[model samples]
Target: MNDFERQLQELFNEVKSMIMMGNKNDAIDLLQANYEAVNEQINAGNKGIEEVAILDIIALGYMYIGDLKFVQSLLDMMSGIVDSLKDDEPLLDAILLHMGSMYSTLENYEKSMLVYQRVINVLESRYGKTSILLVTSLLGMAKVLGSIGRAKKAVEIYHRVITILELNRGTESADLVLPLFSLGSLFIKEGKAVDAESVFSRILKIYTKVYGENDGRVGMAMCSLAHAKCANGNAEEAVELYKKALRVIKDSNYMSLDDSIMENMRIDLAELLHIVGRGQEGRELLEECLLITEKYKGKEHPSFVTHLLNLAASYSRSKNFVEAERLLRICLDIMTKTVGPDDQSISFPMLHLGVTLYHLNRDKEAEKLVLEALYIREIAFGKDSLPVGEALDCLVSIQTRLGEDDTKLLELLKRVLRIQEREFGSESEEVMLTLKKVVSYLDKLGRKEEKFPLQKRLSNLRMKYKQKVQY
Candidate 1:
């Protein structure tokens, strides 16, 4: 190798070793030093592929440290060089791949998708269809598409990638795993839980065949399957699958599994348990998960706030409103400081705290918090979203308990009904519940004329629900 190449390789090794040793700051410093040295070399007329390679290494290090600004700077520099080296297809392709990944990391999905598509077009035009080089760009494009809420398009691209991999590397090859996983996750996001379950089951079988039952990948697939089952409303079965997945993970070597992954699995299991009326068990598991997350990730980390939210949910499920309120406040404080008060994430804790306050007979405080949450939800998810419906439901309950006038409550109920009907259909249990509430308020206000029609609608819904249950 040339001197510059050798030096870059040595620097890469050093940075990798430091990162593996858990000395991330040391790694960053080493990378930064080498990056400046490469810049000096480039300024001294030593610029070439070696300089680009060094920049790539530095960009990767910055990415590891979540230093997106530095990463973006490096990406821009690389893009300029790649533009000058348009004839060098391999180098240009490599730079575009990194640029796409960096844009994705920064949540610039549009730019990421464009870069990936350019890479794919270049690779396909040069090497023809079904080239292995297209896999990376295709996968990147699929992920960006999914991130930008184009799940169907993402799924199509993912399937295309899977087909190419299966044709080139065989069905059971590990190369198919990632595309399959992405496809399954997209299915889940699209609310196609049955499809997700099928995909995950296939993945579980593949992992089991390749790495045995106790492999961490197998455990992860099991967890994915469990989530699909839970989404499908098979909570009891999901609970069993989660337990099995946890056992597999725990039985594996500690080095093979990430602590954060285990923590997330525990959280999922706890959530399912809570859904199945095992609130105490779920609460204890969440408490354990919270302590571990705080110890490892620190209290200010976003994951720590997520654990706190999950634990608060457990507390609320167990009727410990005081504890739930305290935990929600902590989460709200952390999110407000870290993500700002106006972030959509804060709305969840606000809504939860509002519910807890309502249960505690603090109607005024509950109303204020719920209104704030509703405003945030409306801004973030629009007026017809399920989250807006939920926030409105909480607000209506608080208003009803506060003895608000029927007119205001009626308006709120109608809004809730419209949202629920749009989301879940008129025959849904949610619509039935809202209809009953609307009827009750109408009757109480002595509006018998309006109450009769709502009562008739409620009766029809009850019949539909009964017939559905019977069949």
Candidate 2:
């Protein structure tokens, strides 16, 4: 090793010794004190492999101390040197990985992906395919893809990385846990709940063996498993799992308690409870979550908007339409400013607000808002989507309450039924519900012939459902 390398080694030894002696504050101070001198030396023509080594050591020190701002500054400085070290491929790769990680930490996922792809290309050229060195870049790419809503692509990449790690390491390797967890989450997003359940079960097993059953990581896995269970229509089991997860989080030491995680889990549990008819309990939990979220995450944060909307839903369930409308209006204002008027994110709040308004006897305003939400949902998800069907139902309800001419309401009901049939098939519960609405509207319009066909279809679907359930 050269002079810079020798110095870095000494610093590393000193920092490690300080940590061993429980003098982490002193170690951080020493690293901070030496950082500027190292940078000045590099500026004064000492920019070699050892200079890069020194920078990496300093960056690691900042990371150890959890000072991400300093870590970002050090990575930015290293980025300027990375291009000049083209001949030093390994050093270039390391610097690029550091930069990518910093970018990811800052939520600049697009830039993170660009840097990670470059690292992947360099590693592939240097070491060929199947190299363990490609693992980090692959993992980063998968994460960026998932963040950007490319769930299928993210799943593919995650599986590829898992296969490589399992082959190069072992089936039970710790490295497989993260990818498994990510894959499970992606599966859930894609509505593959059975697949998600399988992946999360594996993760739960791994966490149980490695970290013990009561670890917070195990709680996370259990929460995910609970989501899958809920999706699979086992609400009681899901409720139990969610409660168990919360218990693990509650039992954790105070310093180890993650407020954001705890709040999110509580919100999820509340939603499940509401779905299972425990509206009072669910509403109380939602109110608690909303308060905590507003206190820490701030009222304007996206997560705060989510909590507000969820609480509004609970209020709506409890027939507290006035409070529901107030909360939903706040959510709409925030969403409009953050995501713009026409974004798909605005649709849910608009629809909920419209429903609340309709309940409060404001049909005209409710109709306008519901129409806007319908337009947005149709543009984002097409006319035949489930969301569009829901929007149509809202419009139908508003028009019916206004006592409008039966023609338009009847046509709207028919359209909703068609959309449901296309999306869920004629035998599904969604189609059955839409068919009933269509029959009611047709009968009110004195179109007995039109009602006859829908009535027959509903009867057949109910019989089919009963037969399946009985068997």
Candidate 3:
């Protein structure tokens, strides 16, 4: 080999050795050095394949960092590679898949989606339309899009994934459980509780036959079943499922399985307990979990703030207003520091603090804080959105208690009702929420007429949904 070729081979061998050693920091350093060397070589008109390999190494290292900026750089580097790559090139499909993974990490739903489209295109042209790679890419992309809030695209991709997973699994295979869980999760997010319940039940039957009732997979299935149960207003059933999941997680820890898996499971169990009226128990679990989280994530970390908020909610539910208010204030201050005052996370603590103060009979302070929250929501979601309606209800509730029944209170009520009807249909939970508020508004305003209509509507709804099963 020529002298230039010999040096380039040496550089590649050094990077390969670093990567094989599994020292991620050392590998990254070597990759950076290779990148600088490649840039110099490119500047001197060397269009050799080693430059592409160096670019690949650099982009892959950035992928390991996982923060959004690094993921962005990784995706940008992939786009550069894609533009330069030819169809049917060796490693081209693999590079595209890595690019898709980077976009997925960055939460770039649009780009992740487009790269999957390109993946399918390439797979169809080269490997035929029915290649397994197509299905794999679709499922992977669906997970990313779902995580990033693109539910429609996720549903579409999930449908294709279901078809492929089923085809590959045949009718009676246990592998169908995987996609069933994925689609069930999406169905839960979409409020299709019946559909999610069906999928979860099917998966539970198969998984139980294979792994029994107390396996970790079974624990997750139980947790998912709890979500479905909660959606159906079977809070009692949901609570039982949460307990079962918790027992399984505890068992797994006792058996020396992965603690990280059990940790998140325990958190979910605590969260479910809080959701189901076992607030004291939930608070205890959350407090213990918070100690671990605080050690790892610190007090101001968003996840720590999340656990604190849940504990605060439990305190509020148990009527421990002093502790609730204090915890909430701390969370609000932390959120304000990290996400700023205008961020939506600030509203979690803000609303809870307002609620606690209102319960403590500090009406004037509650009204002022709630009014600020309403103003922020109005700015964010427009005056007629569902969130605006929620703020209006909280505001109207305080205003009524404070006896501030001016024309503005009526205007806010009307706005809330409008949003409730526009967003949630007449018989839905949100409509019921607004109706309950309207009844309260009328009661405080001495409007027997308004109260009668809302009462009648609620009675009719109860009758219409009379067949709805509880637990």
Best by lDDT: 1
lDDT per residue as tens, model 2, 335-370: 888899999989999999999999999999999999
- Weakest 10 consecutive residues of candidate 2 by summed lDDT: 249-258
Off by over 4 Å in 2: 1-214, 224-241, 250-264, 342-344, 375-386
Clashes of each: 0, 0, 0
Instruction: Kindly give the stretch of ten consecutive residues in candidate 1 with the minimal lDDT sum.
Output: 82-91
TM-score each candidate.
0.63, 0.55, 0.59
Best-first order by TM-score: 1, 3, 2
Predicted model with the maximum TM-score: 1
Model 3 ranges off by over 4 Å: 1-28, 41-50, 66-85, 107-111, 124-133, 143-159, 162-178, 254-312, 318-471
lDDT of 1 by residue, 133-180 (tens): 799999999999999988888899999998889889999988788999
lDDT of each: 0.85, 0.83, 0.74
Candidate 2 TM-score, C-alpha based? 0.55
lDDT for position 169 in model 2 = 85
